[model samples]
Target: MEEKLTDRMCPNCNDYLFYMEYNTEIPYEGNITIKTYLCKSCYYKDVSIKRHDMEKPKILKLKIRNKNDLKTIIYRSPDASIKIPEIDAEISPGIASRGYITTVEGLITGIKEKLSLMDSHDAIYIEERINNILKKNSEEITLIIDDSSGKSKINSGRAEVIEK
Candidate 1:
């Protein structure tokens, strides 16, 4: 139920968007979990988990056609300026290749992994893969998993984790 963003066109580059499917489960008291494409373009996997903290599951289902698209997802989090908590979103491109642990980019990477977000889309295009990992900051997982709480953090374009 988000805005049916099934179709999105990156203003910078016109690469068709394809959401890498994701299935997530958050824990009631433990860490959040996510299951997404390990190699989405090449290998797709079915993931599942049950946690008490995460009242329900949320799937981000993301796709990156080019560098511009990738950058948007990663930076958009902090730019929103809202502290995200206990999340279970999925993203493609499982690594961060952008910055170090002292810069804004670094915080983005840290937040992503903490949020339990996976950008592991099996990239079919070698060029895209290289760009995503090497040029687009694959080391960082922009999505985050805040402390487990009985609440939902998924919106049309954002997630809001809360306590019950």
Candidate 2:
């Protein structure tokens, strides 16, 4: 079932935001609830996934060897952390973090975009490294998603999951 509630004030802009929740059943994953909040005023948005029957936490790793690997799908939970050791960058889970579903290429592009908004000195080097990976000009890069909530996943056969 789906439930929707709107008019919630956005923390950033004090504007009305829309909130929606729904439950879905996956073949082997049982019941899961998804909640989404969106604010058109300040462009604030967040998505969260919760499993009715929670499972053990796990770490998912996918090595991007070539361009094909960049097409791999990734579903990242808000409670998960993303690390690209090759580029020396890590997106830690915190209040600022958000859940998202995107491809490996999209994830890398997002890193570049976020870094572009920052004023750090090392942002240039990190952006260059990200570009090399995106252009398929560098060695293999590993994308790691550490999810304590056990809700994040890389939808690819090449993805390795290590249970914690």
Candidate 3:
């Protein structure tokens, strides 16, 4: 019997998939059967057969690069346990090779982290601090002003640091 499955994009060819029905003469009990489709390039059935070995995105090695000069670094793994944030895009679960971390906010977080600490000379202390920050789940760190502005400085607003 053929059953209609919800529309899903074919992971192999990145094409749209839809269910279809046909009249049968052998006498069927069910209403529908799930079918594979791709118009002229049907690869859904084959991909399903070997779906077990599909590679999952490794959060550790995933890197984000830009399309501009490519020399400016967006983000790099500062620690070993980086978590990949789930995005709504349907493009492969792969990290951005060219435009992932292209936003100003993302750039800020990336560059701040990259410039935060020294490599070997300050790894231990910075790691501890980072661990503490992560454990606290603090969204933003606020800095309070101790001394008032001399003449024309704004002293009321707080500068919050958001860790990525």
Candidate 4:
């Protein structure tokens, strides 16, 4: 892993901000670069990731059933689209989107955090459904990821991969 820390101006506060960059290799995957910005004045922060190697576009799918499945790791590229149809939840790549690696449970927790921030009836309903899924009250849920960069993956034996 390579790390660098620098100082820059924060876009939101016009104050001195801390910037960090990391370059590292993931086993079985290519090199990845991550950049982070943090503003001490406004408490603003941002992070982004990019892969050094190019790959063919592909789609991956995984089913979450038992507690063990929640431990499955996921690598989401900056150009990937993540979808959980059962919960009507989807995350599409955008200009501000960042890439990250996390477990299935971590992904669900992230979605829950976003849902809790919304103040709508639909959001409440979805949150409840997601809660049930997390608690194993519901049936199996499928996670589908479409990655244009082809750097994303569901690291599990049950994961299905399709090239596009």
TM-score against native, each model? 0.21, 0.70, 0.18, 0.72
lDDT of 4: 0.85
lDDT of every predicted structure (CA atoms): 0.33, 0.84, 0.30, 0.85
Q: Predictions ranked by lDDT, top down?
A: 4, 2, 1, 3
Expressed as tens digits, the lDDT of each residue in 1-164 for candidate 4 is 43344567778978876777888887535787777787877988877776689789999999899888988999998789999998888998998776788999899989999999999999999898888877874868899999988989788988999999
The clash count of every prediction, one per candidate, is 33, 0, 4, 0
Instruction: Name the runs in model 1 displaced over 4 angstroms.
Output: 1-53, 74-164
Please list all clashing residue pairs in model 2, or write none if there are none: none
Please report how far candidate 1 places residue 5 from its true position, in Å.
53
lDDT of 3 by residue, 1-164 (tens): 35354457677776666555444321111122223444334645521111112122222122222222122322221111223232111122223211132332343344346535546545445444444434452233221111111111111122221222
- On TM-score, the candidate that comes out on top is 4
Candidate 3 vs candidate 4: the TM-score winner is: 4
Instruction: Mark the regions of model 4 whose C-alpha exceeds 4 Å error after superposition.
Output: 1-29, 32-50
What is the overall TM-score of model 1 with all chains considered together? Answer: 0.21
Which 10-residue window of candidate 1 scores lowest in summed lDDT? 77-86
> lDDT by residue for model 1 over 71-154, one digit each (tens)?
432322111222312122232222332111133333334544443443444322333433354365564333342322223222
